[model samples]
Target: MTKVQKGKLISGLSVGKKLTVMVLVMLIPFSLITVFLLYTLNRFGNSYNLVVSNVAIANQYNLEFREEYDSVLYQMVARSITKDMINEELGLTNPDDMTENVRQSFDKLVTSSTSQNARKSAESVLKLLTTLDNRCNDINNNIIKGGAYDVNMSALDNDIRVITELIQERISEYIYYEAGSMELIRSAMEAERIKLIRAIGMFFIFFFIFVLFLVIYLSSAITHEVDILVGEVKSEQINSRNLELKLLQSQINPHFLYNTLDNIVWLSEGGRKDDVTGIVTSLSRFFRTTLSGGLDYITIKQEISHIESYLQIQRFRYRDILNYEIDIPEEFLGYRIIKMTLQPVVENALYHGIKNKRGGGTIKISMHHQGGDLEIDVEDNGIGMNSEDTANLQRLADGLEKAREDNAGFGMANVGERMRLNYGPEYGLKIESEYGKGTIVKILFPKENSN
Candidate 1:
């Protein structure tokens, strides 16, 4: 593949890899949350099912116990009747004695039962049997021995009915209590099931939203940075082209240099030492500054001094027609700026704005602080540009050709390229002008102290 195509492919691959890694990072927590939610939901479902089954089993046990209790009551009544018949056959007459005898016999019957529940049932039966036995004995004794009906057998019958009714009522109460307990358990289980469902739904909704947001954020952040990198690469390619042009331009025209130096030498030989000395000194200084390459950054103070030196040479060449002023804040002298940044803009002001005028105009340079940025303005009250010229200026500022055949100034394009290379596109030169009025070129930079 061609080198350009290879560069594009590599850039795409790198960005894709970063996106994949970021997606994985975002998904990890979401995956864990999903697993935890599912596990918790499974546990809750199992617990709900278990509780429901337990309640059903408890209900069945309650029914069985109620039936058993009723059977025990029936057996108790039957045993009481049998005991009364036996006591009557034996002719037991005294109430106290008969009671004692029946109580002892009933205790024995209770002991004979096979199960503990049966034995407990027998105790209640025995109490009833003893009452009936005593009543029968009293009736027999009253009839045979000619005493009044002393024991009140009807009252004993009523007492037996009351006891039976009490047992039935107790059974009914137990049934009611058991039914209420089952209902409570069912209600609790239903509430818990609803709560668990709601909790699981909310967890899924929130987790989904969080994961979605994270994915979007990661995608946006990675894509924006990649775009910036791509732009920087494109800018670097353009700068490479410009560097090639500059290198080619550095080669000297020997004939022109020889002629200029010969004139200065002849003037010195003719006893014009002061003029020759000044010209030679300016030439030396200019050549020295131009050849001092490989340095990219310098203080604003140094840049201003370099501009002043260049302006001094220009003034000697053009006489007093050109006047310039540089107004900079004292505190900003220490701030670092790109080398040759201001020199190019200043050159543009002098060449395009004041060079062709009948009488040259003033060039004003001012620097100040505004909020978190430094503002530098190069204003020239010379032959200003019209609307079309302003449009061309804007195109040139964006590193595009506008009226390139005219070759308005070399420095405008150079300064714009340097600004974009150093601080990105947001900060650069902004030019404002009106026909025959004036031109103002502003350079915006981030405040060094703020940085």
Candidate 2:
């Protein structure tokens, strides 16, 4: 009735539960083996104990009957002993009583014997004992009557001795039969034992094989289910990531616009008419690229243009403190990338790197094609971070940690998540920094054919 036992396919079975079912199934054979061994032993043990018991009961008066009967007869005839003397010397009871005791032993043997033939042999010996006992009584009477010595003596040799010898032989035959039957019982039991062992062994081996296959099947099924579940989760993740990136891309941040407008008003008030117009143009270009006609993906040429426009406005605003450059090959710009990919890296460099420096700092953007991947390096000579801070920030860039909007490097984290979600795990951001020196953010991407 068990699922594994019936080999039914159940998709919901988890990998961890498969071991429990297999262990339970495998125990069946071992349990059966134990029960069968006990049963066989008990059965054959009874047969063996029965044969030994029959032999023991039959052996009570075994060889002594012949010798004791002959000696009693001789003593009576020679007058060497009276009947009371016979009783004291030979430990003999009255003739009838002695016969009765022996008959009872034979009867017990017959009843205890398992074999019909042994019981019949014991019965025949019991009848022979009766005849022998009667003859012995007659000889005793003759001795009491003061008969000729030859009469009793001849009778002793001819009648009593013959019967005792015959009875001895019969009793011996019974003992021999009962004793010899053990070999047959032992042989039969041994044959059955081996046969039973082989049958059980084969059953166990086949059962074990079945259990192994069952485990393998369950493991395979669970793995298949797990793979499918993981695939579905990943699919939902990709969709969610795409939606999140689109939301981040939907419009420029209102704070940047407000700040730029505030800066523009200050420049206008200072009578810097040319600086205000140039800033206005850059701001317009930055917003134009930010929208990009609502497309999620853009050519690297467009993406670089977008980042350059944002940096230009920031450079003008920071005047003496921030300098920037873009050094990508014209030929490499045709390949596609997610929109706003480089903007976050550039913004991070400007705010976290250059803005914190004592003196003015430079932001350098360059690209290198490494094997199957295109690597974009954004280097900044600014107040860089120590190893511990850099390591924690790396987790954000690798998307190992979630990025909050209020986070210092939220833009870069979003960029990194977009890179990995759009392309693959291999395509992401790498940040290297030395405290008090500088930092470089390397963005990796597969060199796909241009859109």
Candidate 3:
């Protein structure tokens, strides 16, 4: 739907793009944190309920175990008493041995039952078992030896009952302690869940506020720059046509014109009227085309003719030092270009590249229509430039701030600026050069924008 959704806004987009990126970055972490917090809160709430339920279950189980242990202890005591009666009736000689066996069996049962509960419960059970064992030993000794006939059986029964009560009390105490601790844990978890929810809410609010501030600041900055650029473009459109006219008029060198006129006058006085007439006719045609600023746009054929006239005048000046040629498709003759645009690039190749060579060089100009663009190239096999000279030429295309003392030139800057004004920034001069080889100047314009 949008460039950001397609991932194309990451690098190439403007300030608005940055806002989208920031929002995305903040939202991912925010969503993750929100999900984690909700999960934790839900888990904690469930765990607290589970712990409460388990505490209740443990209490019920402990009560049942305590009741069962009490019944088993009572039965063990009854069995011990019955064994003493048998020993007395049989006149057993080793009653102590039988008593010890019974004590051992009772201890093992008590230990196994108490292992399920806490420390207090186990200690209480052990104490109860030890007391019962002592009572059994006393019964065996008294009945077998027929001594202590006045012993109280009620005291022994009361002692066993008291031990059973103590064991139950210990179990109750443990259940109470565990339940209290679980309640405390549930309270703490509830408080922590509340705090986390608040923190997440505050984080979202802060994130939204920061995004709002950033978007406002970026919008203002981008709008200001765009407005300034629009104004500059409007100003250029208003002034460019007049500037092109002035440049065309200034193309002719006044001193050269005067000298040529003098030569024609001298030739007329010497009876070489035919040669004088030919020079006059060429000069007249050249000035007429150069000064005609009525039409701001003209066909490629017309611009090429204008350049031919300019080159002929230069050829008269540097007769053998410069050679020129042009090749254009017949179909492209009707295609239009800004007036006087192509000629200046060729002039730059002559003055900057070939004029300084000793043996002179050939200048070849060619043009053709590509798919959606026009390609024009001016190449010369003259004294080519070094890397630094090429860089300097590039700077001149933007308008020379400071003239180079070594290689002073003018046509490159004027031609480049005119091209930019006429056909946007894309259409301009591109220079390629290599030292001791040659130089090529290329001009590109849109085919759709032609006449």
RMSD of every prediction: 50.8, 48.0, 48.8
Q: Global CA lDDT of candidate 1, please?
A: 0.54
Models 1 onward score TM values of 0.40, 0.45, 0.42
The runs of at least 3 residues in candidate 2 whose Cα sits more than 4 Å from the true structure, single-residue gaps closed, are 1-252, 449-451
Candidate 1 has which clashing residue pairs, if any?
A: none
> What is the TM-score of candidate 2?
0.45
lDDT tens digits, residue span 1-451, model 3: 7967767646666878777788888767666765765576466545445434434443443455335434433333444443434445444323335324434533543343322333344344455456555655555555456544334233233333333444444444434433444434545554764575465556656677775465445435634553453344334323322222122412444765796778777778889877677777777766666666544467888878877876776676677899988888888899888777766677667777788788889889899765689988889998889999898887776533322323344556656655664467777778889987789888888888795
| TM-score, structure 3 vs. true | 0.42
Model 1 stretches astray by more than 4 angstroms: 1-272, 291-293, 400-406, 449-451
Candidate 3 global lDDT = 0.59
Evaluate residue 252 in candidate 2 and report its C-alpha lDDT on the 0 to 100 scale. Answer: 52
Pick the winner on TM-score between candidates 1 and 2. 2
Clashes of each: 0, 0, 0
Better of 1 and 2 by lDDT: 2
Tell me the deviation in Å of residue 73 in model 3.
Answer: 99
What lDDT score belongs to each candidate, Candidate 1 first?
Answer: 0.54, 0.71, 0.59
Best by lDDT: 2
